[model samples]
Each structure stands twice: as structure tokens, then as C-alpha cells.
Target: MLRGQRLGCLSIRKGGSVDTHVEAVLAELAALEDPRMRQVNERHGDDHGVNLTKLRGVAKARGTDHDLALRLWATDDTAARLVAILISRPKSFEASELDSMIREARAVKVHDWLVNYVVKKGPHAEELRVAWLDDPDPVVASAGWALTADVVAKRPELVDLPGLLRTIDAEMKAAPDREQWEMNSTLAAIGIHHPALRPQAIEIGERLEVLKDYPTPPGCTSPFAPIWIGEIVRRQSAG
Candidate 1:
């Protein structure tokens, strides 16, 4: 059990028994628990954890604590779940399990980690992603777009740039906030990697004006697609 505002007193170890590793990780996280973070995490509906930075340190220690990670995820502790995503072996998951995780996920962090770290890197990423695009679940759909954005950025050869460009043009404004964000990224990726589609991407950005009104912190790129796409294209050109 967790001590008041402290992580559970479990003892985890790198390369140790899974039980030991889980315990040690929990104990370490418990020691680093921050009350202020818990208040913020609660807003995400059941994220149970300390700060992500500390959880990452725990994952680095284990590197690939598959069994330990599974056990941790079952605990529903926010920090433990994040560690689970980091250390779980991609090959160990079945397709059904991946779908189940998305359906069960209640926090955006879980959705992000599953898409960015787990599914996007899985062997069936493309296969799974294709179907996710049409999934009725918003989390799954958002993840599809997110995974697509990654594919568009790193493996453009695998994507149908023209088709995705059309999809972005059609669905972006009506999409949910998270899905719209990833959709914008897809637009940016298309602009950065596909020369023929770059102008079209810019046109889409101009039309949507998504994130145009959002404030940009000093020294940070604007999240607005027109601005974001411009910076990405500028970097690609400079290189």
C-alpha cells in the first residue's frame, strides 16, 4: 500500500527477479512522489503516479522489464503504468490486448504512450493503424492519426501522401481536439517530406487556421499549422 502521498513501498531492481524489480521501482517512485503532481494527474481521471521524469528513470534501470511492467500496469498507479509502457516488450502484446488497452485507457498519457511508444513501434503498426482510422472509439482513432503522422514523418514511402492530404483537407476541422492535433501533424509531415504535397499542406493550413489563435511562448514555434508547417519545411530545406 502507498504511504501517505508516498509511492507504494515496493522494491524493484534492474535485471533482478520481476517481483523484486517491480517492488524496487515502486519504492523508488514512492520516494520521489510529489503531491502537486498528484493533483494534476487526478484531472486525467485515474492516473495513479509520481512525476514522469522519475518514472522514466525507473524504466531506464530495467530497460526491458516485460514481466515487471505487466505487473506494474495491473496496479493502476499512474507512475507504475507509465513505467509499464516504457519497459513492456512490444512483441509480448497480442492484437486483442492492444485494442483492449486502448479501450480501457482513460488518461491521455496512457493514450499517448500506447500510440507513440507501444503501437507505433509494433510490428503490425501499419496493419493495426489502418483499421484504427475507422474505429468508433476516439482514443483509437486519435491514435491512428498519431501513428500515421509518425509513419508520414519517418517512412513516407509507406504512406499514400496524396490520399492523406485529402483526408486532412476533409476531416481536420471537424475532428476531436486530440485527433485534430495529430491531423495537423500529418499535414506538417506531408509538407516536410513530400515536395509535391507541400503546397497543398500549406493551403490546408491556411484554410483551417487551426491553433492560429493559440499563444506561442517565447522561443517556441507556434502550434498553428501554417506556422508549424513553415518551420518544419524551413528546417528540412536548410538541411
Candidate 2:
């Protein structure tokens, strides 16, 4: 029998062990950490080296257990927290639940993963996105931008394109690093998806010089909005 362990406001029991299931998963994750992957992950500042494909397998084996997820998140292990996000119920975060997680989301991977795995799919996603846009916390604000960008990409007509363009024009260079990436991508999305705004987006791209000099990877479209838009426009014209 394993010893009892409980996070505030939540409890678990498995084979007479408190959170034993969570512990079991953690043990598995600890064994899977690869040194090379750890080195790469550390460079990215995420502090976890477990292969993602294997991690998913772990979640699959354990099945969906929000109780385990929450307890794993409460621990300090980076990989465990990632697994927590992976295993947790997609829309189970209650009011203020996200706020608590955001506080500890110091790593970029953690911030991005939580947003992708939890926040964007939740009922409060749109509300939280708009509200978090102006939040003081960089991570929250970054997440807000990311969520908005994704929505804008898929459904440009629903967002205030002009306002977003304005922000991209005015603040992207000065915004936080993650926020800049999101804003840049949003500008590209506008150019790619909204023909009427393509010129404006390209112009903004020119002014910002965002990715102007970025070396495009072989066979990959350049991330620079102007170049990316030009290529797409050329392809469309040819077609």
C-alpha cells in the first residue's frame, strides 16, 4: 500500500494508496528521460527530456484521470506537469484554476502547452483570451495573443482585424518575446486568409522588417510575412 497524498481541495485513493496511480505514472516518466533530449529541452528552457510520443503512451496507459493530473501538476517535476496537462480532462479547469497554473508557468513550453491542451478548448476560452490580453503577467498575455491569433487564423471575419493590425504595427517589436511571435504570426494569418487586408499586412511587414532577413529552411516557406504572402499570392495567381 502506498502512503496517502492529497492536494488542497482534491483527494485520491488507489489500491489503498493516495494518488498511487499518479505516483505510478511519475515513476514511469522518470525512467524515460533521455540525456540528449534533456540537453535539448534544457536549451529550450523547459527542463524535460522525455520523448513526447512516449509521454503520450504513458497517458494512454494510465487513461484519463484528472485527479492524477492535478496532483502531478502540484508537484515540481516538469515532465510530471506536462503529463498532468496531457492527462487532465480538457474542459475541467474551474474558475481560477487556470490562474493558479499560470502563476507557475515560467517555462515557455509549459505556458504554450497549457494554453493548447487546456485553455483554448475550455468554455471560458474566448472570455479568458480577451481578458488576458491586457493582463500584467507576460505568460497570460502571451496566451491571450496566441488564442486570438489561432481564432483569427481560422475565422478572420470574427475578429477585429484592423485593431489587431494596429497592435501588430505598434507593439509587436516591443512586446514580450512569445507575444511578438504570436503577433507576427497573426499578421501573417491576416495576409494569408483575408485578401482585402493582404496589402496592409504586407506593408506592416515591411515596416517591422519582421523576419525579412530570416533564412528560409530548405523546401519550407519563409516565416517572413511579406515573403510568405508574396509566395502564396504568386501560387494563387498561377493556379
Candidate 3:
């Protein structure tokens, strides 16, 4: 029983076993925290210190529990939300709920996991994608572009490729960092996936020069769109 404990609007029950369950899960997450891990994750703008491998282990133990997921999410703790995303039934959440969640997820890993593991698998993905694309907030808009980039990679027929390139060409250089990263991804995807559009994609990437000099560790691909596009295309052809 969590007694008087309250997480956001959720009232922790006085004597109920459900509160105990949430308490236990949170305790487990707390136990996994490491300062070293937090420092590494902090570099990427994620707030939690729990090792992801251990966090996923916790989720596997809990399995899918939408009710628990909601409770965990209401806690607004980054590690708990990661577990919530893992155990959530993606299609069960309303579009508005997901919209709110994304906006509230300030931590980078929480935002990324919520988008990739929950929202992307939900029925409202395309709806949210459209709604979020033009959002005034650049971070929210970045998620929109992330979804758009996914579509460009896997379902190219559904998007206006030239329009996307035009947007990237005109706006990417001035776009905020988060939004520009995903926009660059979309540009790379267009070049890699569509042979006919490859030339234009490469040209746009070269012209924009976004992330052109990004420092990438050896053995990993660069995020620079022109180089990323070329390397991926070369790999595909070689394969």
C-alpha cells in the first residue's frame, strides 16, 4: 500500500495491493540506477540512470499490463515511463493521450521510446503524424518528421517525395536541431529507397549540407545525408 503517495493526478490507494505493486516496480527501477550509466545517458539528454538491458528485463518480468502502464506513466519518472512503454498496449491509448504523453516526455529516451515502442505501433500514428508535423513546438515537430522518415523508408509511395525534398532544401538549414536531424533522415531515406529520386535527394543533401561534418566514431556511418545515402545505397547494391 502506497498510503498517501500520489503520482500526478493518480491517488495512491491507502491499503490496496495495486499501490504496492507500483511501489515494488519503482523500487526495482531505483535499485538499477548507476551514476556511470546516468552520465552516459545524460550526454544524450536522457535523465534516467537504469541500464536499458536491465530495464527491459524488468518489463519482460511484468509482461503486458496496460493498467500498470498507465499508473507507471502517471508517475512521470523517466525509468518508470520506459517500463510503461515496454508493457503498454499501444493500440489501447487514445490519440490525444499519446499527444499529451509525447509533449510531457521531456527526457530524450522517454520521448524516443514512447514514439518508437508505443505511438508508432498505435492506430493513431498517421493521424498524430499529420497533427504533429506543423506543431509550433520544434521538439514535437521532430517526432512528426521521425514518423515521416519511417514512411519514406518503408512506404515511399504514400509520401510526396519531391515536396519533402523541397522542404528539406528550403528549411533544414534553419530548422531547430532535433527537427533538422529527422529531416536529414528523411532526405537520406528518399535517396536510399527510390532510385529515380536518388539524384535529387543527393543534390538536396549536398546543397543543404546539414550534419555534413558531424563527428562520427569510426566503424559507424555518418549522419550527413549525402554520405549516409551513398553508403546505404552502396551496401544495398553490394548485397
Candidate 4:
């Protein structure tokens, strides 16, 4: 558990013989304290959870070492490196690792890649969708949900977009203070693009009351409120 300063390393519970894996890693690191190790570790710091590419080979040589690298990626800054790993070595990360990657990716490009790859012809679309909704960053979650809506609209038979919409709705309801502007914006875009989810999007907009308290971000006007008011006015006049 990560509390204050000391990070608990991964351990195994086998017959009460507990092992502090990180201590063993430190021992190995002490032995390989050469400039060559430093250079390699730095080169591939983003991967293999270390600064050197030499560590990659070394980690690969030992199962325990590989687990240590994964442990580093499990719950911290090294988690960001999982994005790089997914891009380069798609098959490297396990399910938990992908979830960790989603949690750590705060950039738009990271969401873009994850959305695109997960929706492709693969066996992990459901996992990807779950990751999208569960992501800590609202922007990433919104992008993921929007992508799901888009893919569902395009190929309705493959996945259930409506169900995911309900999921989004449920999340919004559950987290009253969750500011999901980016996710809402993405969903609005999806609504504009997909006919099926437009009505649902409008309903969601109504539920959200976007115009009631929409904050105009600095240097930017409100996107949804104006469009929402205009659409309502148009319909009223036509009626």
C-alpha cells in the first residue's frame, strides 16, 4: 500500500515464507552499479520500469525481476509507461496492467490510442469499455464512452451502445460532484454524429441541466447551452 514515503514492494504468500521482492531487486541493482547499467536503464526507463535497456534483458532473464517491473507499473508513475508499452508492445500488458495504463494516462493522445486499438478487431473490447468508464480522468472516460457510442452506432449488432449510455447516466447520477464536461462534450459530439443516441443525449442534457449552471471556461464560451437553447427554440417555433 502507498501511504506516505515508503512504497511497499510486491510479495508472495507461500507457506508463510514472505519475500520482499524489492529488496532482492535492490541487491541486484547494487551489484550492477555500472555506468552501462545506468545508461540502459535511462534509455528504456519508460519500459521495463527501469532506467536502462540492460535491465530489460536482466528482468527478462528472471521471473522475479519481471514481476518487480510489473509491480512498479502496477500502481505508480511507472504506470504511465504502460501506455508506451501498449503502443509498442500491445501484448505485453495484462488486464490489470491495461487498467493501470488507463488510470495513469492523462493526455488526449493516450485516450485516442486506447480507444482506437480496443475497438479494433481484438478480444478486449469489453475490457476496454470498462477501462474507459473506470478511468480516473473524465476526459479519457468521455472519449472512451463516445468511441463506444460511435462504434455501436456503426455496428449496432456487435455491442450494446444503449446499455453503455445507461452506464454513463448511472455514473453521473452516482457522482454528483464529478465534473464530466469533456465526457459530456464527447457524448454530445457522438449524439451529433449518431442518430440513435441523439435523443438519449438530449435527454441526458436535460437531466444534466447544462444551461442551468454551465460554467464558461476562461477564453471559451459554453458549447452545450447555446446549442441546447437553440434546438429547443426551433422545435417550439415549428410546433
Candidate that would win on TM-score:
3
The Cα local distance difference test for each model comes to: 0.77, 0.79, 0.87, 0.49
Give the C-alpha lDDT of model 4. 0.49
Better of 1 and 2 by lDDT: 2
Give each model's clash number.
12, 0, 0, 6
Q: What's the residue-level lDDT of 60 in candidate 2?
A: 80
**Model 3 C-alpha lDDT versus the unseen true structure:** 0.87
Q: After superposition, how far is residue 93 of candidate 3 from its true place, in Å?
A: 1.0
Off by over 4 Å in 3: 1-9, 12-18
Worst 10 residues of 3 by lDDT: 1-10
Query: 1-239, model 3: which lDDT tens digit per residue?
Result: 00122235464453554597688889999999999999999999898899999999999999999998998898888999999999999999888788888888889889888889998898988888888888888998989999999889787777888998888899999999988998898889888988899999999888878999999999999999889989998998899
Top-scoring candidate (lDDT): 3
Flag regions of model 4 displaced more than 4 Å: 1-75, 78-87, 103-123, 130-150, 153-155, 164-171, 174-186, 210-239
For each candidate in turn, the TM-score is: 0.83, 0.85, 0.93, 0.41
**lDDT, model 3, position 109:** 85
| Model 1 C-alpha lDDT versus the unseen true structure | 0.77
Which of the predicted structures, 2 or 3, would earn the higher lDDT when compared with the native? Answer: 3
| Pairs that collide, model 2 | none
